[model samples]
Target chain A: MTAALETFDLCKTFGALKVVDRVSLRLPQGARHALIGPNGAGKTTLVQLLSGVLRADSGRILLAGADITTSSQQRRVKQGLVRTFQVTNLFRGLSVLENVFLAVSERQGASRQMFAAAGRRRDLIERAEAIIEQLGLAGDRHRRISEIAYGQQRLVEIAVALSLDPKVLLLDEPAAGIPSRETSLLLDAVERLPPDIAILMIEHDMHVVRRFAREVSVLVGGRILMTGLPHEVMSSQEVHSVYLGQAGQKRFTAGVPHV
Target chain B: MTARSELLERHSYNPIEALYWLLLIGTFFAFPNYLSIATTVVIMALFALSLDLVLGFAGIVTLGHAAYFGIGAYTAALLASGGWREPIIDAVLAGLASAGLALMIGPALLLLDGLPLIMVTMAVSAILFEAANKASWLTGGDDGLRDFSFLPVFGLFPWSVYGQTSYLYALGWLALLFVLVRRVVSSPFGVALQGIRENRARMRLIGSPVIGHLVRAYTLSAFMAGIAGAVHAQTNKFVSLEVLGIDTSVDVVVMLVLGGIGRLYGALIGAPIYILVKHFAAEWNPYHWMFIIGALLIVAVRFGYGGLLGILGRIEAWFARARGTRKP
Candidate 1:
């Protein structure tokens, strides 16, 4: 299978500490991969580098075989690589639908047609509505983003990311702040996405990991400790050592791991 | 109406905006044949509105906009004085000179924010004021430049000091500037600027070159101010250092604040109120009139950051709430 996204020898350093230490990985097409690690394991930093939010001090990122390591965040989005924030970054003052509309408008190039009524664009509105409905956000579209429930806010964040028509969607803890009820809704939306696209997600909850991710990569101290099926990775002893506060002495051990 | 409805309504130009424009043009047009004081009021109102475009819509807080205005006046005076003039040449030169100065200063001003930026911009105006003062041969220095022959538009009617022609000329030019500014604010460029005002980091993440956009906006706004300045100089047949003074710069910002920043018609609404107050102040003890105006300004700012429009919006909301309550 062709690789959908690949990072080659990516390195990033803040002073002497290597936040991402010459890491490299290739994600195949249609793979639902997870990046999981203990705190300060560089998972977020790696995601930032992959999504072109931060420049890799030394490396290249290939999106469908095209180098886009140094491109801007918006350029990467335009090229079908988009990301959601760990914290929701939205136009909070505007309505929920307006947020989605602005993102869609970015694609239609109709943001400049000032005198013409922009809300009248039936096709764009329909597309936005479909995304909202698919995410179970139809009832909240007309309300200001601030008025929405927290779980709904997470859905809207994903909706904004989806608005870019991305092929490779990066979700940075999509379930972070919401209650468990909204978490399931978010996971459902992820599962139901079209199969042709690839998703790379950073998730903290083990339940979400077991439910949504087909493949998992565990990062410990800025390096990928293991990559494989979720069961295989989770059933390992080293994964347990890292999770159980004994990563410093472990070499290689295999069996059922602790939380 | 709720805040959302008020925001939506603000996007549309209400009848009040139309009325302001109508009264402005009508007064200016009728002045030569109707009244002189009305022409003066229209000219100041136009100048104030032009400054408000950058101050309000673009979220650019400036205190040196009058530097461009002064530069425009100087350019017109230099080009048209002593019979060294072509109408188009004078107008274009005035605009170019002012815009050039704005462009030169814009980049340097980028690193500053809030009071620092305001202070730096005020310094820029002061620098221009000194230049105008010291450039005796070119600008006539403290004596001020005089004897400007008004450039004839379309070679049909030359600019005149008499009530009708000058007033009509200023009105026509003001109308054209207003349209041009309206088009700019409604463009994608304007939307991007507004986005920057709302969130700079987000705008950068979305691929807007923040400094580049701001510089372009500042240059365009300065160019418009230049046109206003050229009109002012030609109207009075004189170019004075006061155009570059700190007081004039403060006055432009005051007009914007009073009218409410970022609202185009605020400039129109605010300018007339300011001028009328100033006019009355001059009539009543000019010094004490300033004290009264200062007190009013304190009240305006204390209540809301958006000035008169914010106050008006709050009142409208209160009435709507009252009506809704009564209905149930």
Candidate 2:
């Protein structure tokens, strides 16, 4: 089957420093993949390129088997590719439902309506409420983004992406700043997403990566060192000797070996 | 709560908003002698209302909205002088002329944001100012456009020096256009503009045409500003080059900022206060009147971050707490 999302020979640079260097990746439909990397591994930059925020210097991106290299960001989204930021970027001033409603109305083509009040639209409201309800934020539906807890804010990021009905979702460190207790809700939210959609998560926690991603790619210095099954990648010596060489590596793989 | 109650609760018309309109209506009878200032204030309020759509809701941060205002004034002036005696029809035509120009140029201009957007806004008005000055044969040059009189408003009431006809005429336009603006800011299009303002890139990722939506809002703003200018020309029986000047642009910004920014009422609040204070203070003490405006700005910025409406909102919250209502 064709990959749901694909990048071939993708490269980007900022002046003298190479940010993404000829790195290629793919996610087949329904595949759960993880990109594991240390700091400054260009994971976020790659996400930007895919989302068309940062133009790639020389590369081609395909969405469901069509070239979208020069497609605008809105066009990419309309074609079923979406992304969330590494940090919680939300409409802090507006209510939670309004934020999600923006995404839903955009997809439904109701946002362009200049005459009807958005709240009066029963269909838009129902869809927005259902999405909010599914994320377990039914009680906080009327609350502002600033009033929500940090963990819930992270969930909101994914909530917004899901509202777009994306075929391929790129989540950049959704659980980066949340506490251990808070991570469960974020994990649960991720697990409950529709199965047919491909997910590529950039995660630092090996436990979460092992639980969600069937395949993993290790990135170092803007290049993918290896891509394989999670077990093969964890056991590979090159991934070990890089910088997760000492205590960090042991913390992830102490008892990771399977019988 | 059920979705029905939630939507109803938020959308229900507030008594406070009703009172604001009531007070505006009362002004027509409350001070008959000051009708001239009242008319001017009503027109300025409409102008500030136009700027609110661009600067307040969309966060466009313009410094040259006077371009539309002047264009509208000139369109009406030229048409009326050329024998278009109908006031209402000319005003609508003037508004469309302004909106048309906005739709044409706004795509390129709205692409810029923050300080650059501001500087470009100023430059656009400057160009219009120079254009009007050079097109003296048509716009009447710096001497201002005159030698024309509107037919009795709708060919009924005659306009005269008592300011009665002009006052009521301008107020009618204000009320009618106010309703239009009210409908606009509550629509889904307005919500998308807010989204674009808060997070532009995210809006695009959600499939919103950022620049396209902004241009539409900008066009609407131009239409409103145009109407204000057209009304001013009709009411005053003149259209000075100053209508298209930089000072007019900055004053509208001050009015909106002082009244409030995002909420529609903020424009209503700011414009009347700015015009009334300047009108009376200049008559009382010509040299020092600006000091009062400067002081008022300081107080508004320091005490109420959102301007007068912000202060009013806080007061309402305090009263609610004091009453122990704890509304849900």
The candidate maximizing lDDT is 2
How does residue A197 of candidate 2 score in lDDT?
95
Models, CA RMSD each: 4.1, 2.8
Predictions in order: lDDT: 0.75, 0.87
Model 1 earns a TM-score of 0.87
Best by DockQ: 2
**Candidate 1's interface RMSD, please?**
4.0
Which pairs in model 2 have colliding backbones?
none
TM-score of chain A of each: 0.92, 0.94
For candidate 1, give the docking quality class from DockQ: acceptable
> In lDDT terms, how accurate is model 2?
0.87
**Candidate with the greatest TM-score versus the true structure:** 2
Error of 2 at B134 (Å): 2.8
Q: Output DockQ, candidate 2.
A: 0.50
Candidate 2 CAPRI category: medium
